[model samples]
Target: MSHTSTMISEDIEAYLKEHEQKDLLRFITCGSVDDGKSTLIGRLLHDSKMIYEDQLAAITQASKTSGTTGDAVDLALLVDGLQSEREQGITIDVAYRFFSTDKRKFIIADTPGHEQYTRNMATGASTASLAVLLIDARYGVQTQTRRHSFIADLLGIQHLVVAINKMDLVDYSQERYDEIVAEYQVIADKLGARDIRFVPLSALKGDNVVNRSEAMDWYEGPAMLELLETVEITHDQNRRDLRLPVQYVNRPNLDFRGYCGTLAAGVMSPGQRVRALPSGKVSTVARLVTWDGDLEVAYPGQAITVTLEDEIDISRGDWLVAEDDEVPLANGFEADIVWMHETALEPDKLYDLKLATRDVAGKVKAIDYQVDVNTLEQRHADHLDLNAIARCQLELTAPVPVDDYRTSPGTGSFIIIDRLTNITVGAGMIHRPLDSELPYEFREHDSKANVVWNRASVTQAMREHLKGHSGKCVWFTGLSGSGKSSLANALEVELNRRGYHTMLLDGDNIRHGLCKDLGMGEADRAENIRRVGEVARLFAEAGIIVITAFISPFRADRDAARELFNDGDFIEVHVDTPLDICEQRDPKGLYHKAREGKIRDFTGINSPYEVPKAAEVTVNTEFMNQQEVINLLLKAL
Candidate 1:
C-alpha cells in the first residue's frame, strides 16, 4: 500500500510532488552471524504495514519449509530472497529494501554478518548515514560486532543504534538489555561513535521494532522507527566546501554547453566563482539547469547541469570547486585499506586505483601496519591477506585533487582494481598526503641533521606586486641543436624589453659555472638537470620570469622540474625541429664528433632524448623565425 494512496487516486501529480519532497535516509543493519539483521528488517516492514499482501502471503508460504521458527510466520524470509540464503538461514550478500512511513522514506541495507563477508558489509555501509548494529541479547557482544562497528566508524557513520535483539529469549529482562548496552558502550566509546541510541527488540516476535512492545514496559524509549525518522542528518553533509566532479559535458547545440554532475557538497548559485582543477581556470556560475527548469539555488545531492560564464576547457573526470577552496593535489598519500581479494596485496605491483570518476595506475608503496579488528591493535605486516585491514602508503602515476575521508567521504574514498582481471580487489579511505619525491638518503639526512628552513618576511605576493608581474617558468626542452637555446635567449630579451624581471639559465653557461663538475654520463646529466631546475625555481620564486634552455632528455627528470611549480606556472616549450635539422645545425661540431665516437653519450647521437609529451607550446624552428618563436612563447605566457 502506498503511503498516500488516497492522494494518489485524487491527485496523482500532487502525490508525486509530496513524495519527492520527503527526505531519504539510508541505513544498514549488521552484526555477528545469525544476529537477526534480516529478521529485524522484515519485522520493521511488516509491523509498519510497508509490505504488500502478495509479498506477505509469499513469505508466509516460504515459512513452511525454510522458516527457523516452529509453526509461526517467518518474517526473515521477506529479505532473505535468495535460495541459498533461505536454505542456510543466513544472509551471504548485501540485500537492500525500500519502504516509507508518513514521516520519512528509508532504504535499508541488510548486510551479511559472517566474518567472511565483512567486505560486503563495508560496501553497504559506505554511503549510509546511520548504522543499526544488531547484537543478540544472549551473546552480548562478539568479535564481528567490534569489527563492523570499527568499520562503520571508519567509514564515517556518525549515527548508531545498538539494537539488542532476541529479548524474548531473555524473558524481556531489562537487566540483560542493560548489560549488553553497557558492554557495547565500551566499544562505542573506543570508536568514538556519536548519537548512539539503544533499542531492545525481539525480531521474531516483533517487539519494539515498529510498535512499542507492551511486554517491555520498563523500556521508556521510542521504537526503532521513531528514532530513525527523527535523527538529525541534515547537518551531516559537507555544506562548506563546494565540489562538482564533472561527469559529462552536455553540449546539445552550438549555443548550449553545460557541465553536468551532482553536487558532491556545499551550495551553488548564479555568479558564484568556481575553479576547474588540473587547469586552474576560474569562471562564474552562469546558471544552474535541471531537467525541470533553471534553479535559483542548488544544494548537495542535486543532479544539475551548470553553465559557466567563460568558455574554458573542462572535461569528464575534472573537478569544479570553489575558487578559494584548499583542495590538495597529491600523487601519493596514506590510506586505510580493506583488502577484499584472495590474492595478497603486492607492494610493487601496479593496480588501477579509482577515486570518484578519475582512474589511474598506482602501487601500494608500503604497509604501515595491519589492524587486528578484534583488539584494535596495530601490527606490522608486509602484505595484506583476505579481509585484512591495514594502513598503507600509495603512489600514483599523476597528481589529482584529494580530500580526507573523515571529512569528505565522497571525494576521499577509492577502490583498487586488479590490472589483468579488472576485478575490484580493495577499498581505501585516504588519511593524508605524503611527501612524494623525497629520496631515502635525503629523508635520513633530514631526520638526523639539525638544519632548519628559514622563512623570509617578504612574501611571494609582495615580490610579484613589486615586480609588476607574476613569476613564471618558461622551460624549453629538445635536442641539443634544436634551437632551444636560441628560443630561450630571444624570449628572455623580448620579456626584458617589455620591462619584466627576467633570468635566463642556459645549458652551456650553467655547465661552465654551476654544474662544471658534472660529466656527460646519464647519472651526471640527470643531476645536472636537477641542479638547473632548482635554480630556475628559486629565481621564479623571487618574482622573476625564469627561462631555461636545456636538452633535459628524460621525461621523469622533466616531470620532477614541473612538480616544483604550481599548475599553469611551468610552461614547457618543445622546439620540434627534426633531428636531421638539429644535427645539420650543430654549431659546436659535437654531433660530428659523436658520429666519429669522439663525444660519447651525446643526445640524439648515442643517448636518447625523450620528447615532451604535453608541452604548452610546440614550435618548429626550421619553419618559424626567432621573432615568431618569441612572440608565440610570450602569447602563451
Candidate 2:
C-alpha cells in the first residue's frame, strides 16, 4: 500500500471505533487572493489522507495542465474547480469539503480570497463556528487579512485561528511569523476578536498542517489538524430562546395537520407552550414528531413537525417562539449589508428583504457609513458597489420579529433580492431595530413584473384630469366634538355639489366595517390611521377628493399617514377648538363618559392629543362658523 493510503486507512479505522464520541465542527478558510488558502486546504486533505485514490490522480494530472507550483502536483486544483477559477488561479465561489478525523468530523468552507468576492466569503462565514484566516508571511499583515478578521468578528465567530502561511518562502523563520502575528493582534483586539490562536506553516511542503514538522522544531503548539479535531463547538448556538420558524405546513389528509420547521435554537418538548408570531396565537405542543419517530425532546438543528393542541392558525414564515422571548417586533432597521451586485445600489429603489422564509418590501433608507478597507475606519458613503460593505438604514414596508445577530443568528441575517430580476443583490446582518416614534411603511408593492415596475394603465394623473380637478385628501385632525367630522362632512357635501367626486371616511363609520376587528389601544389607533390613509389614497386614485375625519391625536401617526400620499395631496386641516368648548359640545356623549371614567383612551381625556404644529390649514372653530370653515377649505383645495 502507498504511504498516504496507509494513513487514510488508519484514520478511518480509528474514526469508526470512536464514531459515537465524535462531534462535527464547521470552519471556513479565508484571506487575500493568492495567499495560498486553497493550497493549504488541499495540503491538509492530502497529508491527512482524506482524498480518494482516483481524486488524487485527477489533481495530479490537472497540475500538469495549469498549476501555480511548477513540476510538483498542484494541490489548489482540488478545490478551485471552476473554469474561471482554475484559469485565473483564484477562488471565485465558496467550495465546501467534508472530511473526518478520529476525534471530530469537519465541514471546511474554502471561501474566495479576492477582495471583490467579499460577499462570497460572507456567505461561508455566516454559519462558521471558527475562522481559519490566512496571512501571507512574505507580505506581513495586509488589508485582506484585516477584512476577514473584521468580518469574522462581525459575524460573531468567537474562535479564530490566524494561519500565517508560506513560511517556506521566508525560510520558516519564527521571527517573521511572530512579527505578522503581533501586527494582527493589534487589529484583532480593536475588532474584539478575543478567542484567537496563531500558527505558522508552509502549505506546499505539508509542514505543521497535519503532522508536526521537525522543520519547525522551535514551534511547540498543536498542528492545524490537531486544533480542528479538538476545538469544542457544542455550545456555539444560542440555546436560551427556542425559535422554530415555520418552513412548511405538513398536511397529508383530512385527519392530519402539522406545523413543520427546523428548530433554530433551544430545545423543544411535546408540552411546551409556544406562541406563533405575526399572529401572536398561543398554544401547547401536542406532539413532537419526526420522520424517524416521535421524539420526546428535540435540540437545535433538528427538523421536526409540531402539532398544536388547539386548532390555531400557523403558516409559512410564522415564528413559533417561546412565549417570554425578548425578540423585538421591527418594521424598520439599520443594518450592515455587503452589496454583492455589480450595479451601484440606487437610493430609495425598492428591494425584497428576504429573512428566513419571509419576503417584505424594503429599500435603502440611508447609507449610515461604510468601512474603509485599509484604514479600518467608518466613512460616509451615499451608495455601494460590488463587494462594498456598509451600514445602511433599511426601511421595510412591513414589520417582523428580530433578535440581534450577536444573540440569535437565524433571525437576524437576511438578503435583499432585486424585485425586477429576482437576483440576490446584498446580504445583511441586523444590528438593531429602528425605534423611532413613527416606524416604516410595511405595505407590499403592487407592481406587475417582466418590465419596469409601474401601476400599468389608468394613471393617477389621468384619473385627476378626467375629474377636472386634482384628487386629494383633506385630513381633519382634532379632539372629539372639535368640529372635525362636521367640517369633513360639509366639505364632502360642498365638493359633491360643485360636481367633484368625493368620499367621507368618518371615525365611527370606518370602525363599524373596515376597522371592525381592531380594538381601542395605542397600536390599534396607529393601525386605524394607517388603514384610513390607505383608503384615502385609493379613493384619491379613483379621482375622488377623500375627506378623512379621524381624531388622529398623535402627530407622529399623522406624519406616517402623510407619507402614504404624494406631496400636496395630504392637506392636514387642524380643527382648532379648545378643550372646554369640545367638552361643552359633546355630540356623542363620549366626553361625558370619558369624564365619568367609563371610557379608556378617549381622545382629549385619558389619551393626550398632540396638536399639529405646522398644519396646512388651521380653522379656529371658536371664532369661525361652519360656513366660513367650509369656504376656507374649498378655496385651499
Candidate 3:
C-alpha cells in the first residue's frame, strides 16, 4: 500500500480506539460568502499540524496562480478542491474533513454559503452537534448569515460559535466586534441557541485563530482552537432516549436472523429488553455483533447487527426502542420543511416521506406558513416554491413512528421523494404529531347490508371484478378543449346506464371544491394529481368505476399518479388532438388566452407537453366524434 493509505488506516484505527473511550464531536461551519469559514477551518488544520508536506506544496503552487498578493496562503484553497468551486471561488457541496487535538477528535462539515445551495447547508447541519457561524467584521451579519443561523437552529443545533471573522480588515477594533456580537445576541436568543460564544479573529491573517494574537490584546476570549478543544460536547447527543431504527434484517442462515442498523440515539446493551414500534413486540437483546466480533454494548453513531432472544418477525423500516418509553406513533404530523429541487411543494398532493429507514406515503394536509429567512417573519402561504421554508401538516396512509426534533433530532427528521422519479425534493423536521392523544383507529367497518353504498366503495368493487380493473384508475389525460372531459363524462354515463356504479371526477370541478385552495405551478400540478389518485382509490374500494379527466401534461407526474393504483387498475387514455385543432375548438377561450400570453404555464403555449409512451388508449379527436371516443373507452371496459 502507499504511504498515505497506510497512514490513513492507522489514523482510522487510532480514531476507533479513542472513540471507544469517549464521545465524538461533530460540528459544522456556516455563513455568508467570503465570511472566512473555509479559511477558519484551514487555519485550524494548519496550526494543528494536520497538513502534510505534499498538501502544503500543492497549496503553495495553487496560491501563486490563484492567491491575492501578501495574503496568508489563500487557506480556502485547501478545502474548495472542485474545479467549478475553484474557478468560481465558492464552496458548493458539503466537504467533510477530519482532524484531532490532544483533548478530542473532531469531524467538521464545511458547508456552502450560496443562497441556492441552502439544501446542502441543511444536509450538513442535520448531523452537526455544534455550529460555528462566521460573520464579517466589516459587513457585520448579512442576510445569508442570519438565514444560515436560523436553519441551524431549526435543525436542533444547540451550541453556536459566533466567530467575528476578518478582524484584520476592520482594524481589530473591539467596538466593531462587540457591535456584531450584540446583533447576533438577539438572533441567538430568538433561535434558542443554548450556548452562544463570541470570539474575534481573522481567518485569513491567522489572528486569534489557533493562537492568541498580539494585535487583539484588548479582546479577552479563548482562541478558536482552544475553544474547540475545550467545548463540552458530551451533552449534545440524545443518549437518554434509546432509538434504534432497523435499516435491514440480516438473515445469513436459516437459524439466525439479526437486526442491523446504526444506533440513532441512546445506548443498547446485551440482555436489555426492547420493544419494536407499531408491532409492539418485546424482546431481549441477545447479542451486539460487529464485523470483527461480539460487543458488550453499543451506543449512538455505532453501526451494529443485533440479535434478539425471541424469533420475532423483524424487518427494515422498523424501530427498536426502550420498553418504558412510549413508542412514537401517529397518522398526522406538523413539520417544518426546506423545499429543495426545482419543483414547488403542492399542498394537495401525496408524496413519499422517508424518515430514517421508514417510508410513509403521505399527503400534504395544509401549508400553515412560510418563513421569510431575511426577516425571520412567517408569511401565510398556499404553496411553497423552490428554496422556500414552510410549516405544514401532513397525513400519512398509515401510522409511522416519529419524535419532535427538539427531543430527538435523528428520529424527528425526514425527506420527501418524488414517487415516480424517486428524486429527493424536500427535507423536513417534525414539530409534533397531530394525533398523539387520540385512540388508535383500526380498519374495521360496519356490515354493508344496512348501509347505502358510497361512490368510493362502488368504484372499488368494479376495480376488483375486472381484476386489473378494480384497484386501478382510468386517467383521461389530454390538452384542454380536446374532448377529454366530454369523453370521460360520456363514459361514466354509459357505465351508470348499464347498471354499473360509476363516478366521473372532473379536474376543474374538484378544484372548485376539494382542491379549491390550490393554484397552478409545477409543484401544485404534481400535487393535484396525487390528491386525485387518493380519491379515486377510495372510490375503487367501494366497487364502482372511477373515471378522471385532467390536463396532466407531464408524463412523469401521470406515472406517479398511476403508481398509487394496483396493476391493470390504472388506465391512461390519451386524447390525441393537434394543437391547431384544440385552438379551433376553443371551447372555453383558453387557447386564445394561452396564445396571447395571458396565462402562464399553459401546457402547449408556455410549457412543453410530454406525450405518453405507453398510453392504454389513444383517441384521435380529429377522426372520431365524442360518441366514438366514448364507445372506444366503453369497449375497452
Candidate 4:
C-alpha cells in the first residue's frame, strides 16, 4: 500500500471507532450494605485512566488516613461524594458516574445498600436499563441483595450482571463461585430475570473488572466493561406509539407557532397525521421545528417544537399522538406505588398527583396489598409505611390520559405530592385507569359520613306526613343545550304551586358559586355532580322536593349519587333531547362557542354524555310542550 493511502486508512479507522463508542448505556450498582458497590465503580474509573493525577493523589492520601481498603487506595471515596457517606464509610444516596471507553460510553449509578435508603436505590434503578447486582462471595446472597434484585425486577430492568465480588477472600476458588451462582439462580428464577450473566471478581484487588483475572484462569468470560459496551438497549423503549406531551407553547413571534416538548415515545415526521388527546382534534404535522432549524423527522427523547397544519385547542399537558391507536382517557387510575415518605399513606386524604407535565389533585382510595421483597409475597397492608411497595387505587379530580405502565412508562408513572406541603410522598406506576368501579367507593363513603339518622322531634316521616308528600330528588340529566335547566326550573315552579315545598339547582347557577373552581373537563364535571348530589340529598331529607340539573356524564358517578339516597327517593329524569335540536336551540349560545373551539369538554360536542340507562321519567322537549314534560315529571313523583 502507498504511504499516503495507509494514513488515510488509519483516519477512517479512528472515525469508525469513535462512532462505535458513541452508543451509551445506563446501569446501576446495587446490593446489601458494605457490598463494595462504590468500590467496584471506583476501580472501573481508576483502571480506565479516567481519574486525574491530582484526584488519585487525594484518594491515595485519604486511604492512608482512613484505610477502609487496608493498604490499597480507598476507591469508594471516588464515588462517595457526600460528607456523611465518607464519615460512615457507606453509600447513603444514589451517586451517578459518567465514564467512557474505546468501545462505549456509560452512565452508572452507585445506589446505597442500606435498608433505609432502599427507596433511593429504586429511584435510581427506575431509569436504568441494566443492573449490576453485587454478591459477596464470602457471605453468599444476603437479604439486601434479594431486596435490590426484587426492586430491579419491579422497575422493569431486563438485564442483570451478577458480579461475585471479593473472590480473593475465598482464595479465588471456582467452587465457591459456582455455589454462590447456584443460590442466586433460584432468586433470579423467581424474579423472572432470564437475561442474567455471572462474573466473579474482586473490586478491591481489581480482578476481572476491566482486565482478565490471573487468579481464576479456569473461568473465561468478558470483563464487566465489555458486557456493558455490547448490551443491546436501543430497542428497549416504546417506539411504536407516538406520545409528545406539550410542555410549552413556543411562540417566538406571530409568524412562528410551535408546541415544545421531548418526544416521550415513537417518531414523528412532517405531514404525519396526529391527534390531540382529550380534545381528540386531528391535524397534520406542518413542521418539526428545532433549535438547529426545521427538520424532516424527530424521534423519541429528542426535544423539539412541533407545528400543526390546522390550529386547534392545545395546551401544556395535552398529548400529540399518532392518529391510529386507542389509549385510555380518564381522570382516575389504579397504580402501584413505592412510598418514600416517613409518614404512612392515608386512604381518603387528598394529594397532589403530578403525572408527567400535568398536576392535579387525587387521593389514594385503598391499599390492595404490599409485596414482601424477601419472599415476594403479597401481604395485606392497611397503610404503606416508608419504602413499602403496594398497589393502590387513586382518584383524580380531573380526567387524565395515562397509558399502561407496561406499554408506555413515560406517560404512566407519576409522583404523589402532599397537597398542602408540596413534598413528594411516593412514586406511582399506573396499571390502568378506574373509569367506573373505583372512585365510586371514595365518594360513597365521603357522602355517607356527612349524614347520620339521629333522634329528633322533626323526624323525616313526620315532616313528610305534615307536607302530605315524601321528599324527592328529581335528577334532570341530559346533554348541554338540551333545555334541562329550563325544564327543571319550570317543574320546580309547578311543584311549589301544588303546595309542595321545592327548590331547583341549576348547573350554570351552581357553577357560579359552589362549582366555580371546577373545570368543564370530564373529571371536574363528575366532581361537580358529586358535590351537587350531596347537597340535593340534604334537601331531600327535609321533606322538601329537590331537583338537580347537570350533564353528569358517567353512569358510575350518577350511581354513586343515588347510593347516598334511599330506594325510590332519587328520581332520574332523562331529558331525551336530540343533539340536532339542542344544537339548533343553543339557548345559552354554548353550541356556537363549541363549534368555534372556544369551549372545551362541552357535552355532546367534545365530551360525551352517557344517557341514563334506567330513568323514572323520560321527556322529549322538542316533541312535547313544557306542560306535557311537567305533567310527566309530576305523574312520576
Candidate 5:
C-alpha cells in the first residue's frame, strides 16, 4: 500500500484510541463569496502536509485546464465536486473534510456562500464548536457577511475568527484592514460574539494562511494555522447538562439489549444514574461498550452502546437525560425559522417536524414576525417565502422533548417537512415553549350528573327523509375565479328550494371570520380547508347539506381533509376551468391584479396550483353556465 493509505489506516486506529480517551472537536467555516474560506482550509491541510501525492497530481492536472495564475490550482474545487457547482464556480452544499495536525484533529464543515444556500450553512454550523467567518478585504462586510455572522452566533458558536482575506488586492495595507475590522466589530458587538479574532491574510498568495506572512510586517498576530493548532475548543461544549437522545434501541440478541447512540452532551460513567424523559424512569448505567471493548466512562464525542442495570421499555425518540437537569416538555413552541423551500410557509397548516431523532406532526399556529437579515430587525409578515427568516409559533399534535437552543443546541433544533411531498421545507431553532414557566399538572375532574337536554333522539334515516335528501358536504374546488363560488351558491339555493336544509360556506366568507387570522401560504391554505371541512361536518350532523366553495389546490391536503369525514359524506366537485378561461373571465379583477403584481402569493401567479387527480364531479365552466355547473354538482350529491 502507498504511504498515505497506510497512514490513513494508522490514523483510523489512532482515532479509535483517541475516541476511547474521549477527545474530539468539531468546527465549521462560514462566509460569503470570494471570502478565501476554501483556500484557507486548503492551506491548513497543505501546510500540514496532509495531501497525498495522487491528490496533489489531480489538482495540478486540473489547474492546467485553466489559465496559469499565481495560485492556479483552484483549491475550492478540492471540496466542491458537484457538476453544476463546478460550472458555476460556487459551493452549493455543505462539504465535510477531515484533517489533523500534531496538536488536535478536526472535522471541518465547509458551507456554501450564496444567500439561497443559507439553510446549508445552518446545517454545517448546527453542531460546530467554533465558526470561522471569512471576509474579503475589498468588500469588508456585506449583507451576507453580516447575515452569516449572525447565524453563527444564533447557533451558539461562541468562538469566531474574522479572517480578512485577499490582502494582496488591498496592498496588505494595515489601514484598510483596520477599517474593515472596525466595521465587523459593530456586528460582533450586536451578535454577542465572545471570542472574536481578526486575522489579515491573502489565501491565494499563500500569505499568513498557513504560515506567518513576511509581507505583513505591520500586522502582529499569530498565523491562521498557528491559531487553529493552539485554540482551546473544549470549553465551548455544554458539559453541564448530560443529554443523550436515544436514536435506536439495540435488541440484536435475545440475551442482551441496550440503548445505542452518540453522546450529544456531557458525560456519563458506569454506575451513574440516568433518567428516561417523559416516563421519568431512573436506571443505573451498567456498562458502556463500543465495537472494540467495554469502557469505564464515556463523554461527548464518543459513540457507544449503553446498557442499563434493569430492563426497561425504552425505545427510540426518547431522551436519556441527567436526573438533576431540567428536561423540556411542551405541545406548543415558538421558534425562529429559516425557510428553504420554494413553497411559502403558511400559518394553520400541519407539517411533519423532525428534531434530532424524533418526529412529530405539528401545525403553524401563528407567525410572530420575520427578521430582515440585512437589518437584523423583526418585521411583520403574513407569510414567509423561500430564504426568509421568520419567527413562528407551532402546535405539535403531541408534546416533544426539547430545550432552549441557547442552552442546548442538539435538542433545541428541528426541521419542518411538507406532509405531501415529504420534503424538508425549513430549519428551526426553538427559542422557548409557549408555557415554559407553568409547572405541568395532570388532574381528573369529577363527572357531572347525567342529563339529556334534547327532547328527540334523531335517527340518520329520519333526518335525511325530513330534509328530502341525504345530508353531505359538496366540496367545490378549482383554480381561483373558476366559478367554484358561483356554482356552490347556486347549488345551495336549489337545494334549499328543494326542501333540503342547506348552508353555503364560501372560502372568502369563512376567511373573514373562522380563518380570518390565517394567511394565504401553502400551510395556511391547507389549514383553512381543514377548518372549513370540520364546520361542514358539524352542519352535516345537523341534517343540513353544506356546500363549500374553496380553491383547495393540493390533492394531498384535500385527501387529508376528506379522511376526516365519513364515507359518502364528503363529495368533491371539481370545476375544470382552463387557466386561460379563468384569466379571461377575471370576474373579481384578481387575474388583472395578479398580472400587475399588486399582491404576492396569488395562486397560479407567484405560487403553484395543484390539480385534483380524482373528483366526484368535474364541471367545465367553459362548456356550461353556473346553473349547469350547479346541476352537475347536485347530480353527484
Candidate 6:
C-alpha cells in the first residue's frame, strides 16, 4: 500500500491504528466491451505500488502466452483471474480489488462490459458509490456504454467519472476527447448525478492515470487517481432516518439477549426509542454491543448487537426504526425489476422476496412497461425474458416497512428468488408503495380459470366525441349525513340542465336495488363499492357523467374504485363535516339509534371512518351549502 510507513516495522499497533482511521471508498468500473476497465484498474494498482512482487512476477510470466498485449507485460491480467476470462480475454464475472493511497482506502469492483452480463454489472453497481465509465476514445459512445450508465444511475450512484481511455490511440487529440465528453454530457444530464467529472487518459501508456500527461496538454483536469483520492463521498449515507434490520437474535445464554444487525442508516445510541415494524412495538436501546466493546453511538454501516430496555417480540426480517419515523407499511409496491432468469417471469407465480434481512413470498401482479435501454423508451410488455428490465407491480403476502430507493436503499431494494430452484432470478428497487392492498376478491383468482378481457370496436373516445364532452366519475365520500348525497344530486341535476348526460348512483338507492343482498359489514361494504364502481365504469364508457355518493369508509376500497378509471377521470370529493354536525343532521335517525345501542357498525358512531389522505376536492357541509359544493365539483370537472 502507498500508505506503508516505517511505523509498520517499528510499532505495529500504531500502524494499525493509523490505517484504520483512513476513509474507505467503494467504486465500480463499467462500460462497453474492451473499454479498458480491467486495464485502468491494473494500471492504478501497478503505478500506486500496491502490488506484491510474487504476484507481479506470475502476471508477467502469464502475459507472454495469454496476454492481449504483444511483448509488453499485460497489466489487465491482475484482475482477470478466472480461466475462462483469461482464455476469452473478456470479463465474465465481477472482479474485486483493494488498494489505498495516503489519504483514503479504496475497494474497486471491476465489472464486465457485455450486454449478456448486465446482471453482474448491476450487482457491482448496487454497492458502489461511484462509477468509472470508460468510453474508448476511438468509438465515442456505444450501446453497452449507455446501458451501463443507465444502470449505474438507476442504482443510485451519486458520482460519475467518465474515463475516456486509450487517448494514445487517438493521438491524444483534444477534439476527439471533447466530442466524446459532449456526447456523454447529454447522458450525464439525463442521469442528474450530483457530481460528474471527465478525464482523458491512456491506461496502457500511464498518461493521466497517476500523473499529468505531456501528450494531452489541453486537458488540465486532475488525474484519475487524484480525483479518486479527493472526491466527496461522506454525504452519500442516509443519516436522517435510523434503520436496523434485525439479521439475527443473539441469545447465547439465559441472561443475554441482543438484536444483531448492521445499522443500515442514521444514528443510534443508548436510551433512543426504537419501534419494531409489522408489530408496532416500541422499546428503548439499552446498549450497543460489539465484539470489541460497547459503543456510545452507532453510525451507518456499523455491525453491532442492540439490547433493548423492554423485551418485545423481535426476530429476523423485522426492521427497528426510530419511534417517530414514518416509514410506510407496504403490502404492495411498484418497482423497476431487472429479470435475470432464463424462464420468463410468471406474473401469477409466487417467488421468495428478500429485502434487507426480511424474507417473504410475493408475486408480480402486473408489468407496467419494459425499458429500451438504448433509446430509453417504454414499451408495453406482457412478460419479461432474461436480462430484461421492466417496471412491475408486486403483491406481498404480508405488509413490511419500506422506503423509496432514493430515501434509503438498504430497506428499499430487494431480490426475487425462485421458490423451487433457490436461485436468484431478479432484483428490484422500489419506486413507491401502492395506495393500499387490494381486497382478496379484487385479486386474481388462483383457480387457473380461463379468462380474458375482450376488446370492443366502438371505442370510448367515439362515444365521448358524440356526447360533446368527456365522461367522468365524481365520487363523493364522507360520514353518513354529511351531505354527500345532496351534493351528488345537485351536481347531476346541474350537469343535466346544461344538456350533458349524467347518472346518479346514490347509496340508499343502490342498497335497495343493486346491493340489496349485501349487509353493513366491512367485507360486504367493500363488495358493494366494487359493484358500484364497475357499474359507474360502464356508464362512463357510454359517454355519460357518472356520479356516486357513499360513505366509503375504507381508503383501500376507495383507492380500488379510483383504479378503474384513467388519470384525471376519477375525482374524489371528501365531505369534511364534523361528527357533531353529522350526528345533529342525521336524516335517517341512524346516529340516535346507534347511541341507544340499536345500530351496529354505523360509520362515525361504532365503525371508523378513514379520512382521505389525498382527495381531489374537499367540501365542508358545516361551512358551505349544497350549491357551493356543487359549484366546486363542476369547476373541478
lDDT of each: 0.89, 0.86, 0.84, 0.85, 0.81, 0.91
lDDT of 5 by residue, 323-371 (tens): 7777878888889888888899998888999987788899887777688
* Model 6 error, position 621 (Å): 56
**Tens digits of per-residue lDDT for model 2 on 1-637?**
1122343466887645566456888999999888899999899888878888999899889888879899998999989999899999999999999887656778899998778788889989988999999988999888888888888888889899989899999998999988998898788777655578888888889888998878899999999998887777777777888899898998899778898888888888988998988888899988988888999999888899999889988888889998777667777877888888998887699999888777789898777778876566876576899888888777788878876777778888899989999999998988888753343343466546433333323457656666778878999999888999888988888888889998899999999999999988999999899889988989988878899999999999999889988899999999989999999999889999998999999888899999898999999798999999998998888
Which tens-of-lDDT digit does each residue in 16-92 have in candidate 3? Answer: 57655654678999999888888888888887788888988898888777765344487788888887877888899
Model 6: lDDT of residue 119: 85
- Compared to the true structure, candidate 1 yields what TM-score? 0.69
Using TM-score, give the best candidate's number: 6
Candidate 5 vs 6: which has more lDDT: 6
Q: Which ten residues in a row have the lowest lDDT in candidate 4?
A: 436-445
**Total clashing residue pairs per candidate?**
0, 4, 23, 2, 1, 0
Tens-digit lDDT string for candidate 1 (142-173): 99899899989988999999999999999999
Local lDDT at 632 for model 5: 66
The segments of candidate 2 whose C-alpha lies over 4 angstroms from its true place after superposition are 1-22, 436-637
| Runs with alpha carbons beyond 4 Å of true place in candidate 6 | 1-4, 436-637
Candidate 5's TM-score: 0.65
Candidate 5 regions exceeding 4 Å error are: 1-25, 66-71, 253-255, 437-637
lDDT of 4 by residue, 85-193 (tens): 8888889888998887766778899999988887899899988989999999999999988899988987878899999999999999999999999999889887845
Q: Model 1 Cα RMSD, Å?
A: 20.6
- Give lDDT for model 1: 0.89
Candidate 1, which ten residues in sequence have the lowest lDDT sum?
A: 437-446
lDDT of 6 by residue, 1-637 (tens): 6655898899999988988999999999999889999999999999999989998999999999889989888999999999999999999999999998889999999999988888899999999999999999999889987898899988889999999999999999999999998998887878957999999999999999988899998998999999999999988999999999999999999889999999999999999999999799999999999999999999999999999988799999998999999888888888999988889998979999999999999999887778887777877676899878998989899988878898899989999999999999999999998744333223364447755455543568757866879888999999999999888888988999999999999999999999999999999999999999999999999988999999999999999999999999999999999999999988999999999989899998899999999999999999997888788887899
TM-score of every candidate: 0.69, 0.66, 0.66, 0.66, 0.65, 0.70
Candidate 3 lDDT trough over 10 residues, lowest sum: 453-462
